[model samples]
Target: MSMLAGATLVASTLLGAGPASAARPPQAPAIPVAGLADPPAEFGTDWHDPLTAAPPVTHPTGKSCEVTVAEAQFRDFTPYKGTYAPPRGCGDRWSKVVLRLDGKVQGRQYDRLGYLHIGGVEVLRTSTPQPSPDGIEWSVEKDVTRYGDTFREGHDVEMLIGNVVDDTYTGIIDVKVTLTFYPAEKPAATKTATKTVAKAAAAPDHVLTLQDGTLTTPRNSERIVAEVYATGSGGGCEEYWYLTVPDAAPYSCKAGDGPYREVQIEVDGKLAGIAAPFPTVWTGGWSNPFLWYVIPGPRAFDIKPVEYDLTPFAGLLNDGRPHRIDVSVVGVPEGQSGWSTPVNVLVWQDAKSTRVTGKLTAHRAGDLTNSSTYTSGSEHRLDTGAGHRLTVAGYVDTSHGRVTTTVDRELAATSVHRWTDGESTDALKGTWTDDEKVTVDGHGPAVTTRTDRTYTMDGATTLGAGDRLRTVLSLGDRASVVETRGGRRTAWSRLDDSYAGDATYTANVPRDQRHAVGTTSERYRLYGSDGCYDRRLVTVQGTLTGVRDSC
Candidate 1:
């Protein structure tokens, strides 16, 4: 669960899957990014040894089964459905499906989670990863491949392992589930020829709930978007909203108490791509299960509507001219002014795809000037000799401490492709010895490797304003790891939406090596504070938690 394969193909669809075949038909699906080719057909944990007796079974796709349940009384519950059918004519070659789960749960107590239905919906959901380091195993994966039309309509795909962990609590909960199919006989969708630029009718898209959220336009596309919906009003730490393509800009700032933020994309301006901001499918009211986790997925929904890819700057948005697509937001929601957060500014033009030439030399971006100190550094470069060559440097030093608001954002990036969604945040309201360091590098031989990284977050938090105060939160991640490139081993694997450790790759990182680089939490709340009380701190996947509303 080192952040669970850094998964974040969040709603992806371009479809591609057509390789690997012993004549195909073993159920097919190994979700290796889908297109298929090599081996691609894996299942783990000896095919479900003791999963918890079930009431469903119809294997065929890489057949493997098991279900067992011994006891449970207190907060008792059960929902272990099943389904695996894929030997028919193969619905338009469906193309895409990957569901992996390695298990090991010898409970000291209990509290389970798992659900990955197919047509009956429920897409994918998991939570049994936290074992590793000798305590047995733990693995997880989900790329439902958009259901492949509910597995070509055969239906029945289900998986629900449940346990509330109460009723005096009984133990035992083991799991293993696998599905890999990337079929494509005649269908796989990948046309390409889009051109939907729009957002000028005086800047459309609304529902900011209160105020301050804008999206400008001048437009030229290759995929430039700013679809927003962050609803947590009153959370700040510089309060962000930026996206300029002309002189390079990409920011979606957040100090923490997150509803799961992260939305940055700047191509001509440098840093291209980073998406994470879509939740809010529904949010009725009363919520404070200790601040908030209203639990149930998408990080508990804040209002949904999140989509950001920027198409890797689509060659800096194809220079056919026209360019000004701005977006603004300053402490929206909860900071006052009614608190609204909604903005939609999209552009997607992939006419035929190539026509590249780049230059983005932003060597600095740390200017809060009189707002109370700031200084950022950069050294960007992007060449597209048919594509592949992106070097980005980094430096940041922020200070505005009285109560606390210090930041240090040192980043590095090299690209030969492979930089999706986004995740890089560091906010400290005060004291980490003041925290400040910089020197991050980047080199991308087509995603080859070269990342000299240095941007750390140690830990700190304190709150109390009276009215029976009680809101203690502590966050830690003594940041450390690689800062070199070349060869086939670069550390800093993948931990989207939250900076600070939880690697996977293996690029060789020994620079300032410091493990346990993240995930060291401590939270306690009691909010009736009456006046001042707002929060923010996220790093879910590497740990470091704290999300707002404490009373």
Candidate 2:
């Protein structure tokens, strides 16, 4: 069980009845309080709730049905188990499905990690927020329409927020989750309506679970995708993997290979895909909970899974044989444990063909490059670099014709870490990039979709005079996607999410004497092809100071 999972807070003034109106013009989300005073000299019993600049889940109108997934109070490692059934009022077909989770906690507690699984399919991965003495409440929403097949039928549900409640930690997490389904609008003709319904629910025909790290797909599977919820946690050094140093370095956390880490997927001993995991900073990260009392670094409350397009391996997996599929992280000690990876496979099958046959045409892998150099001085330093590339191609016979899919992926990372003699002042600057291109032939003109993702981190924590500690941090998550057919651009999109924070507090003292003060902000901007969205949020001393939506 992982020690930390999460939540964030929203100001009472910023709370809305539902998703914001898209047509509304850009403006301040909340009016600034008149004559807002400076922060107090010491910590208080209460503060503003955690919040982010991320957009809310938009819903469609017509008719909707809702179902309660789970409701429980988590105080230990025990998991809440229940059963979920589709809503009766709404038909089997749904135009969109949205998931919402509301949680509240009070008293003293550390961040804990949690996950929600329906019928053995992982739907949401999250972490909890540390609460003030007066307590706090938060909510998060996600689009689970892609998991339509999982919710269409009754399934056993399981949820857990691993925690410990004793004399020192007293916060018990209370949460409730629900799913709302929007029915598709009626069309003029019955045949057209049938087609529209089918297209609307064209997510995946089958959702398969991994048993003992093995997978067996249907013989006629046409497209295959695997999503892995990989997290490095367990309240240990792995939780802060980026700060690890070589064994020779006199650091508290040491890794044999320094701080470069990558997540890789393998099928039957052959590498299938590789991805750079998002460096998540929990609510209590960087030895300071005050920095994240309001806005988390990035993707802290909601963890998005790393996805792999295994269509190139559909030919091999369609053999109807149990094949071993393994997920592993590259930079851990020989016999240590600190990572969790749970996988779910999504498949689309051919209606006409009972068996789809093909062969693996080509597979190429570039040598992995990894290097770490260390220097000892008043300011110890560690410089690290790593990268890898993989390309795979295969063809499968389908109802339409013979189809070929090729996938090319590349990942690279570089970082510079520095710290004092006793680790009084520790800092790091790092960047990771993952680039992928998928091309499919034999379906009209050849089409290709390319995606470029980049992640960054820059932060420093220092212990100064009078037991005073300060931390300054900045993080970024950026990506761009483009699609082209026959060398002509067809569509594209871009996203830039950034966060910055500065916090200070007196260390090694009672909660009431810590005298903590901090300010944090996040700006999320997404634009292209479909539309544009821009939002920024700022918080000072736990109070939401500003929220602007420029687009």
Candidate 3:
């Protein structure tokens, strides 16, 4: 079957729902239908299964093997623990590794966050979709080849999807995770001269996890990178940190510094890296679960970690001593706990050298700029703007010679939130941009890579006549990257992912009587030196109506 046809089949089968009604009476007949249909809508026993337009993991063509990592049903705080062993037939070195998680849930349930860890290295951080009464099944795949080092050995695995299963909320999250590995191809034996393909860089030599907020790297570490799975959650205000207001403002969620939040990494009491966290909206976000019954927000299913090039600090951490390495979310209220930051450090060692020495040549951090103004009136408004910049440079004496690396990062965000008294109508429009540049000057010519990232959210929720609530939202995630050698562009890539939805339902009503109606769509386009991919998905009520591939 075609991709679109397959998607439609899956949506129908998984949701276990019927076709949407064409003509139905609206709760408030006087309110003219504005681009949306009336309710007694499609939502019956279930809705369209959750899905995204992101590209799937491409498997390599070679001998392969699969291993089941974890299988369990999560209903509370308890986690699933098991042992993970490498595939038997697959060799230690793999050309590619893919991790896939399949999950199913039925009955009523709220969106819950989850994670998977092997040997204490976090490999996946995801969130579940609010389930339909009948049930729904979804899957997510990620290319985990970078964590090859962690998978080569037998290690303990832990997985959790914190949830509550009571009489009212009866969904139990059932999940099974597996890994597939493909062996590397042998080099061709040819006497004749042939074009050579540059082999991709090897995976990290070691994957190290933090111990009590401290890190210890290999003495001969030549290159180091740190990835942090930072999330603002705990079913509290931090989950909606972007919409928070200052303490003086009359709002449900309050942050002393307003809605501006930045994720920062510190090493030995000094700033190492800074980043803007992506504003992720769960399936039930904005008080409208119908908006996401078919399509979720960007990065909602597969949460990508904030990466930092920590090679500059390799010298400081290579002393064979545990150094204090901390991750913190700025702008959170003091003494409040709602953020989870689990760190994984990847290290590349100097194979030919027993020990490598280096020094941090430069470290500079500009003052943080944050401003939030609140205006009180019939429509209360809060406006905020924040930014920060950091630059670090260092050199390591490797077996190949001296290698100098420099990293620069900048983050900026602006948001405007407006709401009526008692939050009868709430609206927010926000944008965040993160730009980073890395330069490496070694034995050969200097090479530089620049990446620019942008995220946007424009959404509003309003309560109207007959206790009918409506939400209209649009979200965007875009990025562009360029690699230059000696000031000449060698490679470039661009990505644009956007989502929009309009949904409405009766407020404070039983699940079956809410009369929810929604229309959601997503368009994902990615182009790079390798190739191009573009796909669009649309859903009305609970059925997948459109799935188009333009590229």
Give the number of the best model, judged by TM-score.
2
Cα RMSDs, all models:
23.9, 5.2, 9.6
Ranking by lDDT: 2, 3, 1
Q: Lowest-lDDT window of 10 residues in candidate 3? A: 1-10
The positional error of residue 51 in candidate 3, measured at the CA in angstroms, is 1.2
Candidate number with the higher TM-score (1 or 2): 2
Off by over 4 Å in 1: 1-94, 102-106, 109-126, 129-141, 144-177, 187-262, 268-307, 316-551
In model 2, the number of clashes is 12
lDDT tens readout by residue for model 1, 1-551: 00001101100110111111111112121222321122212211111111110011112244222212111222234655545555443333323445566656433332244444444444444433222212333444444433344444445555655554543333445666665654443322433211111101111111111113222222223223444443333222221111101112122332222111233434334443333222221111111011111121222211233334333333333455434443333213334332233444444332333333232323333321101122233421211111112223322111211111111332221111111123122222211111112222222331222212121222211111221111222222122222223343333321111212121111123212212121212222111111112222333223223333232
TM-score of 1: 0.24
TM-score-sorted candidate list, best first? 2, 3, 1
lDDT of 2: 0.83
Error of 1 at 547 (Å): 31
